[model samples]
Target: MAACGLDFGTSNTTLGRWQDGAPRLLRLEGGHVTIPSAIFFAPGREAVIGRAAMSAYVEGVPGRLMRSLKSVLGSSLLEETTPVGRERVRFRDVIGRYLAGVKARAEAEAGKSFDTVVHGRPVHFIDDDPEGDRKAEDALRGIAESIGFRHVSFQYEPIAAALDYEQGIAREELALIADIGGGTSDFSIVRLSPERHSRADRAGDILANDGVRIGGTDFDRMLSLGTVMPLLGLGSPMRRGDLAVPNAYFHDLATWSSINRLYNSKTLREIEETRRDASRPELLGRLHAVVEGERGHSLAMEVEGAKIATSERGGARLDLGWIEGGLAAEIDRDGLVRHTGDLARRIAERIGRCLGQAGVGADAIDALFLTGGSTGLPHVRAALTTCLPQARVAEGDTFGSVGTGLTLEAARRAA
Candidate 1:
């Protein structure tokens, strides 16, 4: 039986295998190694995953589109069910189905069944909630078991990236691995050397691990609240004259994992009632149109696009013609800095905690290994580098490093 490595991320998923002593990530969808962690349950058609799912949703398909499935793991919503077409599906089953899709694809590509697999997960599924964290991993483990994997194991996403980075090093070095994914930002301090690459026992190599439950989706939420939510009456005054339009609806709309909740009849009715009491009825009218059209995810994608664009340019403009005619908003880099400053600081603080836990100084680190898609953002990269100014920054395959590294681990464990 062949064993493969799976990096099941919040935003994307990748599977890799060891081929002739080299780790190679399998192309899961149309020559792309990384598949968007998205699913669409069409009303009268088969469910779609990855790029096709995103495309189908954007093309106005009638269905429930779900992204950021991993974010629900440690939350109360994990135990709840939501309407996904004609049926109500448990959040756990939704995740299991997604993982099952990944497993089936890998088997088809490899032309063999995989009984043993290694999966990568964040260091902390839920910060400061030990029971929630344990339950989250247990939930994932159960999902893997149900998906036909007889033997399953787990690896920290950041450590997996570190192992992949370590394979190319010429000499021993103390490296900091910063992995900022869609749902979490994790850090690991490890001692790596080419000489140690062949060793099966790497427990001594890893010094410390630290993480916070914040990542790209959180950034998207902040950006949405700061820029897009206002246009939807998020801060508009109600007829009560003293109270503002309820923020919960806008918050749910901005959150990837909770956006689907806004589609229910109760939420829509509440929005309508709020609109009647809203001082700015026109803005709430636009909000009603969005909720009625089930376009929360579309709005979120627009904000995410703006966030990505700001990384390269000074600013980006969002076209919201779906909500209102000729409506646009400009999001600047400085605004991103202001909206995400607290998150960046929290990430930096986690790095400090990792260094302290490892009993290492910032100057003692030889290199900083950056991986995960979220690290591509300028603000995220700056946050970690600013804390460890002495270490040379090295970026691995931003999206594929963890999957490749997990492939190495799977090969070792199988041997």
Candidate 2:
């Protein structure tokens, strides 16, 4: 069987296929170069992704389509989404559809059918669990099968990133990979040896990784709480009491930071209550969509739709102009910094604690491999740099790291 690679993450899912003696990213059929990990049910029995579902959401008919179901994987909620016309489907059912869509896209892109794949997940996914390795293996294999792959194996997300970082470690040395992503922050400590790296492709045993379930997405939430909330009057109204409806609305608004859109029937009530107060579901959905999976755009996107001008523009208006007498205050970029500061400190501290636990010192580590959507943040980058001043940090666009590394790994295995 030919091989493919997958990076199924909290914010997005990326694919890598074995082709022409190397791995290539699978280009989706839609105009978009990357397929959104998002899904929504529509009126015609068709599921929407990318721009289509997003557009419909803004138009106020989100249907049964959903996004960010990965976080609720083990919960009973995964098996029970809202009742759509008496048809009940679980979140995994949506995920199963996503896997199938990914497989179809891979087949189209490679122009051939591949039966096997190598996939990556975070290390804490394996490290924190008493059944870490086993859980990782089961989740990876189950996803592959659900998506139509016959055989598959799993590698750690950080480990894959490490392999991508140094495919050939000419010397034996300890290296740390700090992956701060939309879902969680994780790390890996490996004794990279040329001998081991060369042999890792065959047996997949040359990696040792430690991970934590905290990451940059949390920072986004913190910012939304501080700066974004103030703009929406969430801070004061929350303290005024009897603000459950709007408070819940603001709370849901903050949730957009992490990409957790698979809401319960209760969400309908939240919308209804807000509508009674003259809030538009479409506008609310638009705000949610902006912050959903674009972890790289967290702070900037909070000011989208006329509030913020550019990702680096710093200050922009929050466009509360439509809120029918809402405040017309000016929000600037410094607010983002203020909102994101504590989050940055927390991540830095977490990185330090993880390093200390492994008995590894900053000086002894050779390099810091960075990955995930949030890693693109200047603050996060600086945090890693500050925390590991002695180590070299990898540089690249945040979205390309894990899946791109998986592509590199597939070729290494094939060769």
lDDT of 2: 0.59
User: Model 2 reaches what TM-score against the true structure?
Assistant: 0.77
Candidate 1 lands at a TM-score of: 0.99
Q: Give the C-alpha miss distance for residue 75 in model 2, angstroms.
A: 4.3
The alpha-carbon deviation from the true structure for residue 84 of candidate 2, after best TM-score superposition, in angstroms, is 4.3
TM-score of each: 0.99, 0.77
Error of 2 at 267 (Å): 6.1
Model 2: per-residue lDDT, tens digit, 1-415? 6776788776677787656655467776464445656666766567766556555665657354354545545334555555444476666667777777777777887788878777877665533465644654575478678777776776777766766666545676677777777666767776676677656443343334455555544554655666555444353422234453255545545553223332444554554445445333444443333333222123223433322242246556654443434634454556655667666676667667667767767787777777776676666678778988888676543655667667667656555
Q: Give each model's whole-structure lDDT.
A: 0.91, 0.59
